[model samples]
Target: METVEFKGSHDPEKKIVVSLFWTVRKTIREEGCAPVHIKRIRTSRNVYEPEGRKLLKLSDDIMEDILRDMEMGNTVEFEMTMGTESLRVLIDDKRFSVEATRTPEIEKEIVEKLEHETSKLTPDFCQTFLPRIFPNQ
Candidate 1:
C-alpha cells in the first residue's frame, strides 16, 4: 500500500473536513471498496489513557463529533478500512491531515478525483505529500 497525505493552504474549518471525508468515501466507493471498520479514538485531559470506540458506520454526525472533540483540546483519530485499502484521518489542535493507502494506480485515481472534487467545492483543499516510495519499486 502507498500512503498519500493531504495538505491545504491553511487550516480548514469543520465543514471543509466534512467535504473532504465525503470526497474520499465517494472515490473509494468508485473503486468498489466497502466499509470495513471505523474507529474513533478520543483523548481527554483527565483520563489516564485515551478511549476508543469502534463504530459500525462512519457517519457525518460522528465526523462532526470528532471535530468537536478536537476543538475542545482533545485528540481524535479516525480510521476506516475499505477493501484492501485503509484511510486514517488525524485531527488535532496543531495539525489536520488525511492519510490513505492503496495501490499505485488506484492512488493516482484517488488523488485526481480528490483534486477535482475539492476544487469544485472549495479552494483546492487536497494538496501535496511526501514522494510515494513502493518497496517493490
Candidate 2:
C-alpha cells in the first residue's frame, strides 16, 4: 500500500496524512484529506496540471494498472481511534436510538463537511502525491 500526503484536512497537524486506496468520497469525508484530486483542473492537451500547476499525466499502462488494482474491493482497514456515536429520539412516547453509522442524515452531513474541507486544499499537493502511486510511467 502507498501513502499519500493530503494537505486539506481539518487536522491541525502540520502535514495532513491521507490514504491512496480509499475512495475519493470516503477519504474526503472520513479522513478529511483534500479532494482536490481534479477540482480546479483546466486541460488543454492530454496532460494537465492541478490548481498548484504541477503537471501530471498517467500513462496508459499506469492507468490500466490502477483500474486493475481497484477491481478487488474492501481491502484496507483503519483502526477506529474515535469512538462511535449514538443518537436518540423520542416521538409521542416512542423512543428510538440510532447508531452513528445507521443514520443517513449524519452520513450526508459528514460528506458535506468533507467536501468543504477538501475544497480548502492547495492544488500544489495534488501532483506531489500522485506519482508515488503510479510510478515508472
Candidate 3:
C-alpha cells in the first residue's frame, strides 16, 4: 500500500483537498476504471452511512458538504475504493492528507500529477517576478 500526501497549508488558498480530489477523479478516469464509490465517511460529529451502504458516489455535492463540515471545525475523513486499490482522505481544518493503497507505479503517477496540479495553483512569487526582472541574459 503506497501513499502520496499533500498538505493544505502549502496552498495559497488552502484548497489542497479540493485539488487532491480532482487529481483522484482524473486518475481514476485515466486508468479506465468506473467511478469509485465512497466506502465510508467519518466526520467529527458522527459517522455518515451512505444509503444502501454503497450507493454514494463522490460528487461535487459531497465535496461541498465536506468543505462545509471543515468550515464548521468538524474533521472529515472518508475512504473510496476501486477494486483492490483504496484511497483514504482525511481533512481537518486547514490540514489534509491522502493515503492510497495502490501499486507503486500508480502511487508515483498520483504524486507526479498532484505535484503538477499544485504547482499551477501555488506559483512561487519570487520565481515569477525574479525571472521577469532579471531576464535570463
In terms of lDDT, the best-performing candidate is 3
lDDT of 1 by residue, 17-125 (tens): 5334553555465556554454434434221222365234333454456556666756566565667766665556544445566544544454555445434535433
User: What residue runs in model 2 are displaced by over 4 Å at the alpha carbon?
Assistant: 1-75, 79-100, 122-137
Error of 2 at 42 (Å): 35
lDDT of model 1, residue 119? 41
Span of 10 residues, lowest total lDDT, candidate 3: 126-135
Q: What overall lDDT goes with each candidate model?
A: 0.46, 0.30, 0.53
In model 3, state the lDDT of residue 42. 76
TM-score for candidate 2, please give it: 0.23
Model 3 C-alpha lDDT per residue in residues 20-77, reported as the tens digit of each score? 4554554565455555556777765556556875465444455556667877866687
User: Model 2, 1-137: lDDT tens per residue?
Assistant: 22222234333211112222222333344435433332111212122233365423344543443333333321111111112322221111111111133334544443343334445753213445555434452
Model 3 regions lying over 4 Å from their true place:
1-17, 23-31, 57-65, 72-74, 121-137
Tell me the lDDT of candidate 1. Answer: 0.46
Worst 10 residues of 1 by lDDT: 128-137
Q: Please report, as a residue range, the 10-residue window in candidate 2 with the lowest summed lDDT.
A: 89-98
Q: Per-residue error at 80 for model 1, in Å?
A: 1.0
